[model samples]
Target: MLGTAGKGVGGAVVWFTGLSGAGKSTLAEALLPRLKAAGKKVELLDGDIVRTHLSKGLGYSREDRDLNVARIAFVSHLLARNGVFVLVAAISPFREARDRARATIGDFVEVHVAPPLDECIKRDVKGLYERALAGQIPQFTGVNDPYEEPLAAEVTLDTSALTVAQATSRILIKLRELGYLEESELARAEAPGNAASAP
Candidate 1:
């Protein structure tokens, strides 16, 4: 129940959901190094990365989005079941899809990264907001399309109020609190001979 007990292999699936350019990927990137430093086995399955691999050729239609989320969720569940902690940074616009992922994955934590719409547009890393506004792209997640907010999430980061580092720290703290990192394991990892050991 706490970290990896015996050779059973404990894993966590963290779902970071937010609008594009809302710092979901940014926070996940920041969190990765911290977790690695702490000797945690971690992997990030970002939306853009998944799109290139698992969700190729998927369009912006609602049905396509559903399929995309489903594919990502399946792969994520497989990874988690094998004892690799996974971080997913995707818009994942529908609550139904997210719930399906949770149902499939045994240990899942949903983290909502909520940034103001204006701020997301201003930060538009891919220029998607501009294209959506200009009618160049339709059915964008937060533009013409819908984003169903999670009714219950393990954690919610207000990116508008927190720096990326702060957000990452908050997530790590939550993971520790949730027994993703057992106290005994963390203590052992910090021991002199074990400090350099990898998870």
Candidate 2:
């Protein structure tokens, strides 16, 4: 049920975790179309989008963050069991909450999108890193608050070392190895015409 060749009875959840500006959401967005092209029913649950809608009242406290992660995991579990591949791009900083999500969603793949802290700061388009460093924003994940790196992620992509396409291709290969995708679909995705094939 979990890993059939095509249009399986059950679907998997690919969870992306990282600090702000670390490219978790970007990577998830990049992979969305490829999954759809493979004929899988896929849904993307982005952290900012989820916070604004699903967990609107939640604050940035540790308890609140864990609750938000739980809510995402709950929805992802429901979708995955119903044969929808769920891509969750959340800066779920706490390893404990992430592990809990992994347990809740049995067919889960944890992807740690970690670039260096300095690199993440450099990529901050919203200038959140600057504000946080200036003590304007409290409880920021990488600055004021702690971000517990994944102890054993199924896939780890450092945006500084790998291009977006290369990182995405690696994720595709992992998904194929895990049986959520077929060999033919993988071939098509990595073909010369596909962006994921770019060097």
Candidate 3:
């Protein structure tokens, strides 16, 4: 947590890994403005959006998956080194890929957002689980392919069990615990009537 810091001295990657509909993107979107409001230079990189721009035409094969992850890691690394806090919300199913990312982007916090598969099926917001279960989609993580759970993620949240506010609060707590966030910033964030106010 202390070696290669973000941009000037506070850059870090809050890497969120999980199933497609497990709240990674939603959480990243929610976390960014909070960090920024606390005076942190943060950026959110959603997986699907990255696929369209940073990793166009990448297939679903293992090699392609690795490539996509590496590409995301590369961008996050650059930003982190330059003092930008990168909040990445990617399914990044492979542990090795996550390891590569951790190595590339120092001062990283890995948060695993995993709801039970059955719950995911029930909440299949995009019909992804149903399609994958019915053999309509190939190489779907958690349905057809694999999701290597993080053995030691800095934070793990089950969306089914925790509200968005609760989950985000947990992450903030960890950032403070890791010395990534200052107590004053956290107090400002938690204080009454200042949730959406700018820094």
Off by over 4 Å in 3: 1-3, 6-8, 193-199
Worst 10 residues of 1 by lDDT: 190-199
Tens digits of per-residue lDDT, candidate 2, 1-199, equal: 2222233457889999999988988888888888877777889999999999999999999999999999999999889888899999999999999988988888889999999999999988899999999999999999999999999999999889998899999999999998888899888777665654332
- Each candidate: RMSD: 5.3, 2.9, 3.3
- The most accurate candidate by lDDT is 2
Candidate 3, residues 1-199, lDDT tens digits: the string is 2247643375889999998878888888878877877787888888999999999999999999999999988888778877788999999999998998888777889999988878768877789888898999999999899999999999999998887777887888898888888898777555555343221
Per-residue alpha-carbon lDDT of candidate 1 for residues 75-153, written as tens digits (9 for 90 to 100) = 7777777777789999999999888888777688899999899989988777999999888998988888999999999
Please identify which of the two predictions, 1 or 2, would achieve the higher lDDT against the true structure. Answer: 2
Model 1 regions more than 4 Å off: 1-9, 184-199
Question: What is the C-alpha local distance difference test score of each model?
Answer: 0.78, 0.88, 0.84
Give the candidate order by descending TM-score: 2, 3, 1
The worst-scoring run of ten residues by lDDT in candidate 3 lies at 190-199
- Give the Cα-based TM-score of candidate 2 against the true structure: 0.93
